[model samples]
Target chain A: MNFDDAVRLTEILLGFAFAQQSIEHFKSFPNEQRLFIPRFVLAVLLMIGFQTAWVAGLLFLSGLAMLHRFQGPYNGGSDRMSLLVLFCLCLVYLAPTQRWQEIAFGYLALQLVFSYFFSGWVKIVNPEWRSGRALCDVFQFSVYPASESLRQWSKSPRVLFVMAWGVMVFELIFPLLLLSRISLVIALIVAAGFHFANACLFGLNRFFWIWISAYPSILWFQLRFITAN
Target chain B: MFHILKLLLPAVIPSWRFFDVIAPSPRIQFALLNSANAPSDNDYEWCEFRPRPAHLSFLQMLGRMFWNPERNESLFLVSCAERIVQQPTQHSEDEILKRIIAELKTNHSDSTGETTHLQFRLLLVQRQDSRLQQQVVFHSRIQSLSTQDKT
Candidate 1:
């Protein structure tokens, strides 16, 4: 898809994904949930293609309320990234010129790239992460285990070490996703697989949706700035 | 100079870690202590802080949906406990203990009931490689709780 189409696709997909969680949040916290219910409805409208830009703005305000009600990010990384994506989308809608829209998406793309690269660097610096002990430890104490079989694998140090290195290497090289269409496709597929594995094992379901939403922006930035040039 | 400063910003800024890093070895658990310098096992069990009442399943689900259900303000809690441990002057200890107890009371208070004089001990448990090498990082009476609470 082209950049604009990609942007539209991202908005609809994110709207649908967040709507479920938003409704769940509304149901969970009766006292602070009032604002989120309206946000949930607006998100569904955004998905249904009703006054997309205006709905996006309302969604942005409600998103801010949700952030405040939680006193910070409720789910950490995914929440923060989701907020950024909403801001970027609103900016794209507000931009007066095509050049400004391109820049806005490019900024989102930069944040996405930095997130992975920065995370990888942090891991490589830590002794525990470097030793592969971190992954083993997480699997051992994960809240929602995929199965007893998966938990048993945490006992094998060699397997954990290999998996740790694999994750670190892939994340470090994640920026290479911007190289070309073929590379970007492959990188995204691999990243999707990684996110799917996390969701299956640890039930980090929110991460999958937020991270996938950024892929379109990354693709747009690469095509507009690097490939097209 | 500008490029170097730009490069270092992410390293300096704290947000980048973003729960991406996993801690190794011993898993950390926090236990709430009562005003008597003992665990408040009357309502909630002393083993761990699992939210009671089956109807609050949504809250439990919300906890699992985000991060570990057991950890809330965990890093800050540990740091405060450590500060009290490192400097055990009567004044400092009293100040920290007062703060912790006040926080617990506020968090657990029910508006419908009369104010209660609740004194509880906070225990920081770290389970090591196996069941044997566990460490008690913090108990209410840091110096005497293990013996006192046991009895």
Candidate 2:
């Protein structure tokens, strides 16, 4: 197929994949078959406010998780590790301020900061991802079956390089927005862009939708929705 | 009591775990208790690690919808295969492929000779091999392949 045809075909395939995964995701109500459920659930819950309690419960639980991490039985943290984690996370669960700006900035900063640090950590381990060559290979692996005959632009190294740089720049800068006055808005746009790119470039449809869906609350700053309990 | 001991002694000393399971797919599970004298057999370990599906997340959902379409086909393809097969049996991948191919051949017309079946069997082997080299998700390839077999 031509470029347009390829794009359309990919969309159909993505839909099939999404429906399949969605069926599995909701099979027994929120399967941990994947990582990043927070991002997944939040991106999708972007539209509706009628289900305010559901979101509150989710954020409350996430805050609780932060608390539990340092104090629970599975807490295998060292003295220093425990102290450092507990100090930062306590602000999330117990802090008194409920301002839209602070809550939005803080929550967005925390989630992206954590994800950025972890993701950057993994990327740093591999030199190729940083330089952009590694990403090209990842794309090639997806279309390898028909790589010889097919017409996906992702097969090109230059495209992968631009993508790799885009990802790296976003990760490097996405957390900074959390510290700024207009940081929440910027971060929401970047997160949306990041997920949308994944949908277009890779066959990672669930990642795109779930991540985008979660963007609604983050997009509009509100301590009330972010912290239900 | 003596006969029972005789049976128990041989089984216990054999140094393997044998568990017979009766499910939709009736089968036996066995493991080696002592690797020192473990019976060297192919059935001991099939998949080094069981099939792990792609991660589930909002980000993952997004990836599926907008990015990785080909990656998504495997999910439906697996469901399609599951629906096609009446009796589910867990066997060697090759054996499963062979059985499905035979079923497809039987469903075809007499005008189509056994050559079609041979072509299908060959295609499955090639696809299976290519998947290993290229890392095609098992779920997507399985159904697509079986459909190729049937068609």
| Fnat scores for every prediction | 0.13, 0.11
Instruction: Please identify model 1 stretches exceeding 4 Å from their true place.
Output: A141-150, B1-15, B18-21, B24-45, B49-151
Q: What share of the true interface contacts does candidate 2 keep?
A: 0.11
Task: Summarize candidate 2's per-residue lDDT along A9-71 as a digit string, tens digits.
Answer: 322332232234334433221222232255235324422332433443453344234233212
Task: Give the alpha carbon lDDT tens digit for every residue of B46-70 in model 1.
Answer: 3332222223233443454444322
- Model 2 spans > 4 angstroms off: A1-109, A143-159, A216-229, B1-151
Name the docking class for model 1.
incorrect
Residue range with the least summed lDDT across 10 consecutive positions in model 2 chain A: A70-79
Question: TM-score for all predictions?
Answer: 0.68, 0.39
> A169-188, model 1: which lDDT tens digit per residue?
88889887678889988988
